[model samples]
Target: MDARRDAAEDGRETIGISWSSPTRPARRDRRQRPCAVDPVMEIEIVHLDRRHAGLRIADPARLAHLVGSLARHGQQSPVLLVKVEDRTVLVDGYLRVTALTDLGRDLVDAVVLDHVDEVGALLLRHRLQARRSTALEDGWLLIELLEVHHRTQADLATVLQKSTSWVSRRLALARALPALVQEAVRVGSMPPHAAMKFLVPLARANAADCEAVVVALGHQRVTTREIERLYLAWRRGDPEQRARIISNPRLFLKVEAELEVPPVAPDETSALVDDLEGVAGLCRRARKRLRTGVLERASASERAPVAAAWRETREALRTLAARMDAEEFDGRPRDTHRDPAAGQRRPQPSPDREDVEGVTEHRQEDPRGANTRGPTLRSGIEAPAPSDADP
Candidate 1:
């Protein structure tokens, strides 16, 4: 059956339909008929009367596409609006109103709801229609509904046609994430899930560190795995490790190596081999001392410089290791001739018991200024001090 014929047969008149002429302003039909089931009191109103107060974010491409569709085929659905004093605030169909305005249509079809407040309007919009809203947007809306409007999660679930758990999650996300992180998600700097995965845990554990990392790495294009790795490292690493990661992320991220080894001649290779051996021996002695708890007894002032140097050396080793791994994967040999520590002399050995006793006697005699030699170790063993003219 035709719509008009069916309406007539049901003893009701379709008084909502109206038209505007180019020569004159459009007016609403005065004839009003009551609808039984879906009673939508649609009328023609000025496009300017509508005001958007919903949760949908503005998207230009979507609006442009909507405008094209509306221009080809006029607005098929009426936007829901609620009367506020003399103004009509939009409850839904924001895209339609925007499209109508772009097409220079002075009049738009609207269903003017009666006595609905802002909260009611939002609830009605959610209940009557389904729209795509970002998680951040959902969070903001959920916050407003709960905090500003004093609505409960159950109420939100009922109104938005979502589960109670869904509403709870949205509310929690809104409350837990900082405004900056929310803004990052809203501004498309990162995905919502990624922010929840990467930023939330850090922010919960240490907000300052999270903020620092965000400011440092937010602009960089990092993958989810990289972000997770960085988060884990920042959360558990020592001061030096954290500082190194923050200062030189490219190294941890496996970008370009800071130091490159160039091909070396046979003579340079011999020197490089000796330098590597010296470093290995130094590391062995340091490990032995650490195992013996020697550093644990050191004063803070003495340990500070040692810790700093250790961190620096650790970063250098990491960079070198990454470079070696990359070269190995590419089936290329690294050049050992261009060693970073090239030409530097091997460390002098530590003083023996006799030499130490002599140094102690000298210090006792001249406490003001004693020219005592510093100690060193070789391959987990203490060595005697070198003579001044040994070189």
Candidate 2:
């Protein structure tokens, strides 16, 4: 008997099953007798073992959990089964039915269909059905079902899941990972959840560099931040930056040496005593002289050029500091975003420190007159008070 006919006889295939819109009901003959049972409403257990189940049952935990639930409350749904000679086979519901058995339910409720195709049409039909329905991560659903079916390399088309070749192609990306990276993933050192997110981008950019970073990270005990640092360095850091480490073999060796070597102790006794006595004598003489000789020599040396340069630098720094403070007070700030070309510099106190006393009225003249293109404007200069005269 045809499966369609069997489905119709069992009432499992309702009149409006296929189409989105309902079809008109057939006019019943007046002589037709009413049946005792509504076939569609009844749940019966049919043994269907010969059918090839290709959907993966990979997550055993989930399966066990479902089984536990089923144990508490018997199989609420019937599995679709088709008769094949002496044996009835499962057409769908692989995991759910497995859960039923695991839950210790000896029998399953099933709808009996007449024919069982030698090749599983269920797998193809399911994929086609899924394809029409929604999007998914690359072969994720099919892969899961294959695992459930325990058919890793089975012909997917016949199994109605995925072809063996297709599974191989998709698996290779993950399977071909470096042993060290794989180990890291397995050990929970690298988050398995984010491994793919890290892997795909790295592998696409430079497989060798990706492998190097992974291996390098594995050797040292590293934190997630360090791993992220290395991973991102490869992603966005320039080629020169990557080459600085990779090209220099000695750097790694230097790190190793630092790790292996112990600290050195300072020479004691004579060195300590001689250094202390000499320091004490110099200190006493320097204190007695009050560094007058050093000062006399410094002044006598006609260091006008050096003095002028120092004075100018000090004044410029002071002006800058004043400007910065003014900007801060006014709520207008300078640029803070990093500029690669500008590089980094240590901050110095501005030259405006002494100017705060208001001795010079023209202090607003940018102390660095030549640094900017604009002409410097001079304000009125104020004389020092007689008591506050310069020394």
What value does the lDDT take at residue 50 in candidate 2? 32
| Model 2 per-residue lDDT tens digits across residues 46-160 | 4458344422213355466566655655544445555566676666556666666666566665555433342333542344332231111234444544565455456553454
- The parts of candidate 1 lying over 4 Å away from their true place are 1-54, 57-78, 85-87, 95-110, 132-136, 157-166, 215-233, 240-391
Candidate 2, poorest ten consecutive residues by summed lDDT: 381-390
Q: Clash number for every model?
A: 1, 22
Candidate 2: regions farther than 4 A off: 1-46, 50-55, 113-120, 128-351, 354-391
Q: Model 1 lDDT vs. the true structure?
A: 0.57
The residue-by-residue lDDT of candidate 1 on 133-169, one tens digit each, is: 6665677788878878799888788878899898878
Q: CA lDDT, every prediction?
A: 0.57, 0.45
Residue 57, model 2: Cα distance from true site in angstroms: 3.4
User: Candidate 2, after superposition: displacement of residue 169 in Å?
Assistant: 4.0
